[model samples]
Target: MSISLEQVHPLIGNKFQIETSNGIMHLELVEAEERPRRGVPESFRTPLLLIFAGSSRQPLAQDNYFIEHPSLGKQVWTIAPTLADHAKGQYQRPHEDGSTCLYYQVFFN
Candidate 1:
């Protein structure tokens, strides 16, 4: 089944796992933003932007991954490595986890 913005919005800040050939990488959903409406105006489901943060100590390749959540089940999505903030640098995640790392984003549009 396709994942919708509504299904994931509430799960922000929760832990999610990404399955890669290297192994399982742990990540946290850090940001969610509703994108501008498209297609059938407001009647259509708005696109969404979801950002996830992972450990900076390890390397995370950009690829399609099967993301697993405790309650959200499993869904595959294409995730690309992105900057947390251009001014601040892309690799370091802007979180208070006492550690900084690279951030990844998934586009629902």
Candidate 2:
């Protein structure tokens, strides 16, 4: 199944179990950008983008870069997905309140 931001709303504020190739992955969406602040404060909080490659055993890591958009001005916090040693798996984003915002079941073969 494909995962999208709108598909996981039910799991937005809660922790849920994600079935992955490696095992059941526990994910929680912690939080999203609470409010927007004015002025350039050097940085701004961007929506969390979580990418999970089922076979990865180590901690997921990625670099967050920034770009300036004509409408949004400065766009920051880009989630770069770096796949681990394995292929084919599941991914999801769960919120602290037991809601999930995104989920995907991928098959690599």
Candidate 3:
């Protein structure tokens, strides 16, 4: 099965384990969004883009990681560390700055 965001939408708000060089880490699917290009013609379906957010306690290096989900199995994603959203408040863990989670975004078409 392809590892596109469309295949993973059902697992939103769920946590999945990712195999990393450091070991296994977990990422929680926080949100998903699809935005059409402002100038794209209605006939162009491929122009629609999908984006989703995954939160994890352990920050990841800029690279692709194969994440495993109980139901969805494993899929590769290019994970890039993003600033923690202050709006979410403190997460389950405590970080040096007292904020517990960092975020990553996955993009697909």
Candidate 4:
């Protein structure tokens, strides 16, 4: 079955696990954004951008990772650390609870 925004949208704020050499790292789904482009056919799915917040302040190196969710199962994708749209003034900012967290981003197109 194909994964769609509909299936992932509600998953925001939920935990997703990523397998790393350090073991299984947990991430929380933070944002899901649809980016519509001109000239793209409606038959093609709009590109979706997803961002996840990790509890660790340390950033992970970019690579293909096996990320899993209970309902979404396991899938491999290129994951990279991002500054979370730093222009928004959230770069390296502590979370609501004042805990520092790093952000990662993945794209689906």
Candidate 1's residue-wise lDDT over 1-106, tens digit each?
6567778889988989888887887888877888777564765567889888888765577788899997878889898988776664555444555667678889
For each candidate, how many residue pairs have backbone atoms clashing (under 3 Å)? 0, 14, 0, 0
Q: In lDDT terms, how accurate is model 2? A: 0.34
Q: Per-residue lDDT tens digits of candidate 3, residues 3-109? A: 54476667777887878898887777766656565776666543322222343445677788897889888778777766645666523535334445666766554
Candidate 4: lDDT over CA atoms?
0.82
Best by TM-score: 4
Best of the two (2, 4) by lDDT:
4
Arrange candidates by lDDT, descending: 4, 1, 3, 2
Computed on alpha carbons, the lDDT of every model, listed in order, comes to: 0.78, 0.34, 0.62, 0.82
Worst 10 residues of 1 by lDDT: 88-97
lDDT measured at residue 91 in model 1 versus the true structure, 0 to 100: 51
C-alpha RMSD (angstroms) for model 2: 14.4
Better of 1 and 2 by lDDT: 1
Which stretches of candidate 4 lie above 4 Å from their native place? 86-89, 92-99
lDDT of 1 at 33: 81
